[model samples]
Target: MNQIVTFGEVIMRLSPERNKKFIQSNRLEFYFGGTEVNVGISIANFGGEVKHISCISDDFVGDTAISYLRKFGVDTSSTVRSKLPLGIYFLEVGAVMRPNSISYNRSHSSFSEIKPEMVDWNASLKNCKWFHWTGITPALCEGGYHTLKEGLVLAKKKGIEVSADPTYRSGLWKYGADPKETLSDLLNYSTIFIGGVNEMNEVLGSDYGDSNEDFIEAGKLLLKKFPSIKKIFDKIRTPINASWHKIRSRMWNGDEFRETTDFDITHIVDRIGTGDAYAAGLIYGLLNFDDFKAMEFGAAASALKHTYEGDVNFSSVNEVMNILEGNTSGRFNR
Candidate 1:
């Protein structure tokens, strides 16, 4: 019963080789990743048993995607197949001051057709100790919301620890469901909140400033409103530019506040899925370490993700520990 369960869409990502724009590159590289899948894969890479449940197209593309997950040691037994095509998004990786741009083509994809009846929550969460989800799934469509709600309800009944990352994306909530209401309902079943002040304010509809004091007040208020939430964690990033950024994390465990020092990443290979990396690290850390150390591990994992290309964070636990030990010299390994 120590397995971790992740539920979300599995998307195909296409990007031009190098930092070139779409107009400059004739060849494009592809990777299979989704927010929850990235987290599951990263946790598996860290030697944690993880299972990802999603609906993928019944085609060669879907076959490759499932293979990719298995290649990272993630269990895909819960994955369902659909006749529709798989969802895809294109990325134009940026450098320096230029920012990365993404265009999504997932509106009518296979994952969008997911229904509550399509998944057996009881079976999917079997032997599960932790469950992870994000706002992205619910934002996709009405069925996505209902299906996730079903899983959350069952996961709560099983007494599994649930982590909610309410990534409010206004653009994706085209299904007419109120974002705040949807997220607030899901939070009732979640034990951990893996997002920051902006995310808190979005769900709470409160206007809190960006200071430590404000964060504390906001966290306290959030826990009060949603009594199920035992801890709140946030990854703060200060971007000097698209390629250079500083990252740190903080947490409020309904008792005390803890923060970590800034980690400077002067060169970023790819920024996609870094937040998922943070969430993955936090999930793995909480299962093994104390609250504060978990937050530190999450921040370190996020910093390391910036140095990798593609959508997944491939850093091992030892590699993340090296970052936590302040060993960012990038020296040769014996």
Candidate 2:
């Protein structure tokens, strides 16, 4: 198996219990997840050799977090335990008419305060075939951004493939750095860029509108700027209500543009970590199948994730492959 390494923050996701709104709930349900780490867990569930790198408080809470990663078969040897606090986010699940909302309380998190010395990138990535990260890391804090940047540079030096989810989180980018500049610099070392057309304007300084043609043009502009990018990964999402979503995925692999079949995802169990699941599935497909098949697998994998209750997709390879083969009825096996 190809060893994969994902570096970023892992948070305690506190959502209102029993699908209650934030104001109506008295108790919150907690789950462990983060963008890059979620990707690691999803890949691990599919029998991949993956490692999650993050910083957590040096206490029982941090140890528990590491334990969960280990339970999912994700190697935690590179995780750092520090004296800082753990990052957290409050999620409010949405209903038929209303939309979902999130409030972040991750300021001063151990991962946010991660220093360059805390991560031994060379040792951690020595045998890594793929190194992964997200734009959310750079948006967190200067220290986190630098730490990720150093790792990415080292990955390039070691000839390891690099991938990123250029996710645009306006709420998290409250730091001093400009997202456009930060993403441009970090994406220079990336081989695969995962995000939508809107990110082009939000983080890449492009002036394209929402049309499919505009998206394609904007993608071309992006490829021109970042010569290292060999593939562009993205998906289309349609709102059927707060609880239902219609999704489809697409990719451009330098010479070819491909799209997957539309997937109608109804009755979402948990609204978080869909992007990470998609990214993980795409990476798996890219490594094991053709470019177009990879897109289809990624889309199907993420659609199945909506039925799960947590941030990580525990769906197996057989499950995802079955969905790709038009077995999405969720029927029982005899």
**What's the TM-score of every candidate structure?**
0.99, 0.97
> What is the TM-score (0 to 1) of candidate 2?
0.97
Query: What are the candidates' C-alpha RMSDs?
Result: 0.7, 1.3
Cα lDDT of model 1 by residue, 110-194, tens digit: 9999999999888988889999999999999999999999999999999999999999889999979999999999999999999
lDDT, candidate 2, 1-334, per-residue tens: 2799998998999888857887887888889999998899999988889988888889888888888999988988988888987898888887788787888889888888788899998889877999988888999999889999999998888888898888888878887898888988999899898888887676567678766777777778888888998888897788889888987887766566777779988788876888888999989988899888888888888988888887889889999998878887878988
Best by lDDT: 1
Model 1 spans > 4 angstroms off: none
